[model samples]
Target: MVLLSLVASHSDIDLETVAKISADASQVASVVLASASPVAGAITLATCNRYEIYCEVPQSEDVPAARSEVITQIAASTGLSEETISTALISKTETDVIEHLFSVGAGLDSAVIGEREIAGQVRRALNEAQASGTATGSLVRLFQAASRTAKDVGSRTTLGSRGLSVVSVALELATDLSNDADWSTKDIVIFGTGAYAGATMALLRERGAHNVSVYSASGRADAFVASRGGTALDESTLEAALSHADIIIGCSGSDHRLMSSDITSLDRAERPLVAIDLALTHDFDPELGALAGVDLITLESVRMAAPEEQAQSLREARSIVLDAAETFATEQRERAADAAIVALRRHTQQVLESEVEKVRAQHGCTAAAEEVEFAMRRMMRQLLHVPTVRARELAAQGRAGEYIEALETLYGLAVDAPVAPSMKNAAGCPVTGTQSAAAHHDAPMQSPALRQVG
Candidate 1:
């Protein structure tokens, strides 16, 4: 199957549009798989600033239909118009799909370059797709390679060594806006207990901020704070906590927004409060930013404020991603020759069996006949070796169809369609080895060809 990717990210669309698409992204994969005729499988990756769908289609010609179907499904799920959805997404195919996903997984495409959180987000997207049974073998391989590439980028370069992320960038903005420019003395209140919330808490601590309070509308604050070294706030105490806070960071991603009135009604705090909204689905109202004595920082602000990664480090990381994408593309091309290889092997086996049966009938299963059978089998394997190697070579060069046609013309053989491998490594990586024993059993032997008389 061919790969197709539809991407809507901060680069092409506004963050508000991204957040709107991301709101229902969790269900898009299942919806597309159930309704899209040309889509064999799908995986959705929705982060704060991006919403992307990776699809597997039956053939390259089916791409437009698959893209339309995916957009229709996304519109149906997100209440967006087909025109708007179509306008927002950029479609990527072939090697571009591989390169895009690898760049995304490596955090090269993040608003905060070299952000460590995106790698985990990419991994979780694949896991979610697999759990929903919407992931195909090709997609599994694609994502696994992405994860490996991310790891390589992380290990080989200094891009991600400073622990930079969306949360950290927001905090940096908050520190700058603070009167003291010090985190250790600020009374920080963080909303939500999700991954971003946890990240916020850790970064706050790293800056020596001790008086941290966590509030979760879902009542998870107590457990969240217990392990993370923060005090939990219940509904009755939330207003009191807000009154004392010097900075507020929102990452809850809950629908229950904290309106401007909520902040205005709090008890007196003469000092300025920097409110950082990190959630895609904002926790604080936009009007809160306009309120007196409150300075608001949002994801957009963080995006604009994010520092550029070191040049040499970024170059090194990008090189890693490029190498990984090329390797993945080569492996995919080699797999395309599997059907022709299998067909040729089966044809040779049939001829050998027919000749061996004739020898058995004449020699009555004697050692001489056995030796003759061995010699013939070895000779056939030897004759098939070069053609088998050539099939793979042509496939890698995107010419597998020529090899298949040659097989049909020379031997009257029809190659069976290759099936996606069902086997996975224990670590969930796709098994890229020769798919079956029959295709690889005689791979090692070599010899000269003898004319076949029918």
Candidate 2:
């Protein structure tokens, strides 16, 4: 199987393009299912800075054609021109896809390097795909491994030691000029009741900023405040909240400006109000920065101020990710080899049992016939044990594909035959099978391994 991906992230694509090219997770599933043929399963990861689609396809399929089909589907779903979609995406397959996923899960590819949130995002994406019945088999395993790799990076290295996040950076900037005593006296007004708002509030509470209020552009402010323990403010009280707030956070996900001319009109002491806009689209107007007692920080500024990882830490993080990817690939190869090993063992057993039965019938079930049967069984086991062990060793050494191919050529194993749900992993690798163990003598065997072994 080929692991194929189409990625649009902050690394290459601009924010506007990423937003335009992005598809809903369910929409991505629909597009994968709409492919012509040979598509196994798919998973979509759509976050603030990225929109990625990971799919499993037959290795023999024409890669260029499959990619074009995927691109066409994305264009149709996103209402973007095919050229635009093609330009916005970076395609990866096979080992490259594995490496990219590991890096992403570890936050190496994020705008804020080594951020802790991406690991959860990757896991959540996988869970969502599984829940929607979009991810299966090898695809599931690939994502699960990626999540594990991220965890390893976090726990085993200092890559994630800073716990850097956009919200965290914003908070740092807000408190950079204030002392611990100032935090106790500070009043913070958060404008947005969404995920970013919640994160900001949590960070503020963690930093001992207790006098915080919530302002909603929509009507859900009261409920949000109720859940998170903050006072909700409406339009009538918004000005008052702003007047009292020393720090204002805007993450309302609105295209329109939340800070109007009223911000300038509000009565205030000489204290400067720091406004941090976390929205992808500007929630605060540029003019707000020009106010006499206001300092406005945009998303771009926050990203710039994000903490950088040391070179050694970055190298360690990448090393960890690559190692995890290699381990996952190795395990997959071993599992592939296991299917063939099981098939070969089963074939040998069936042959021994058949020959023993023939001998018994010919010899009229004598004690000598039973001795011959036992001898033949022992001989077969001895003859097959070395080859089975060698096959598994080859798999662990990254030569499993060649071994599998040789096994199929030598024994005519039908490795492409449909397997039961329980037998297949997310990548379409067969885990276990025994139903057709004794049926190999038939022509054109349809078992997952050994189409024919005579």
Candidate 3:
């Protein structure tokens, strides 16, 4: 199996930098169908932070050539100039490929500091990529390990702590810079009280913001707000309430901008309105930031203000991924051994049965010594079944090497004309079935990923 990756840094890259030409699934599928892109399983992962394409291609020629074809397909779908898209991404190799994906899953590589939403984004991206016939073998294993590593990383971190949200960080940033420090004097309006919004509110309350008012689309949420000792306002009334609101925090998932229409929207604000937009897709409009009286801070504005660490968790996570990949390599080798033995048993048995039949044909006498000899050989073969069947089972599960090694030593089965079998491995040799390590090595290494951590 072959593995590769496409990565784009935030500087020159646009999410559309990797966005497929097909806005929807059916359109992309049509393109794949037309290209005769020998992809058996495909997956397209697109997000604001990064865009990636992975696929499982059938045996044709080289994997490197196949990699080039996949990137070309992605470029065609996106309508980006070939050079532009190609520049945005770089291929990952060896442990680099596996670890990078794990970082993404772990949310260490998100725009927002420790944003948990990235996990879901990665999952959705993998699902789409798989649908495109771009996922199989190593790519499939890579994603599964990435996802597992991500889960472990998240569980271990203080990521889920209330103080870890972008919203909390935004409020703190705003509070530090803003001269109007009185929580009771400043009217703060919170729009959309989802997890992000909720976390923001908790932070605001911790800052002793007594005059906090929360608004959500659901009317029933007012009681939930009331229980928290904050005034509940209908989200429908947010436009009118903006005049009284000194600071506005928005965490809505709407594609359309909620506030600001030209300079007039901010002209109504009595003070410098601090509007914080904290969505991956940017819930607020960019034009609003240009408004005279509006002090709009969005994901783009703070896109530069990421978690201060160069992702130490990411660095540590890479180490974990490397270790996992190494463990996997060992398992793959052991599996190859099992496969060699199981094939030898099947091949030897076939020759023995055929040769025995031929010898029986030559002896016309029914009760000849040759017939008795044939019967004993047949019984020996039958007796060997006990060990052969066990060895095959172990080989199928990736442990056939020990059994095969023992049998070879016991029976001394040898091919006079010796050549290294065509088994795929670190050496890049292709081995034939039964003669090679297909059942043994491939089977043991066949699992999507070995769970090294919870």
Residues 311-413 of candidate 1: C-alpha lDDT, one tens digit per residue = 9999999999999999999899988888778767876888789999999999988999999999998999899999989998998898988987787778877
Stretch of 10 with least lDDT, candidate 2? 431-440
Off by over 4 Å in 2: 23-26, 34-37, 60-62, 176-181, 191-194, 215-223, 233-245, 252-272, 281-294, 363-370, 395-401, 412-414, 417-450
| Model 3: per-residue Cα lDDT over 1-454, one tens digit each | 3344556634346543333322232234324433544443445565544655554443325456656665576667656666765666676654465566666667656666556666766676666544433334455566777677667666665453343445655776676557655665778887665656666677777777877777766554587586566777774666666777778877754444564572264336355677887654555666666766667776555566655544565566556656666655444334444444444555566667777676677875567847676776788678767775676566446455456556557655431211112223344332222323234445443222111111
Error of 2 at 243 (Å): 5.6
Point out where model 1 deviates above 4 Å.
419-454
**What is candidate 2's lDDT per residue for 274-368, written digit by digit as tens?**
88877655567768888887878766676678878888999999999998888887776676576677777877778788888899889977899
lDDT values for all models: 0.84, 0.76, 0.56
| Among all candidates shown, the one with the greatest lDDT | 1
- Model 1 residue 431 CA deviation (Å) reads 22
| Top candidate when judged by TM-score against the true structure | 1
In model 3, the Cα lDDT at residue 367 comes to 74
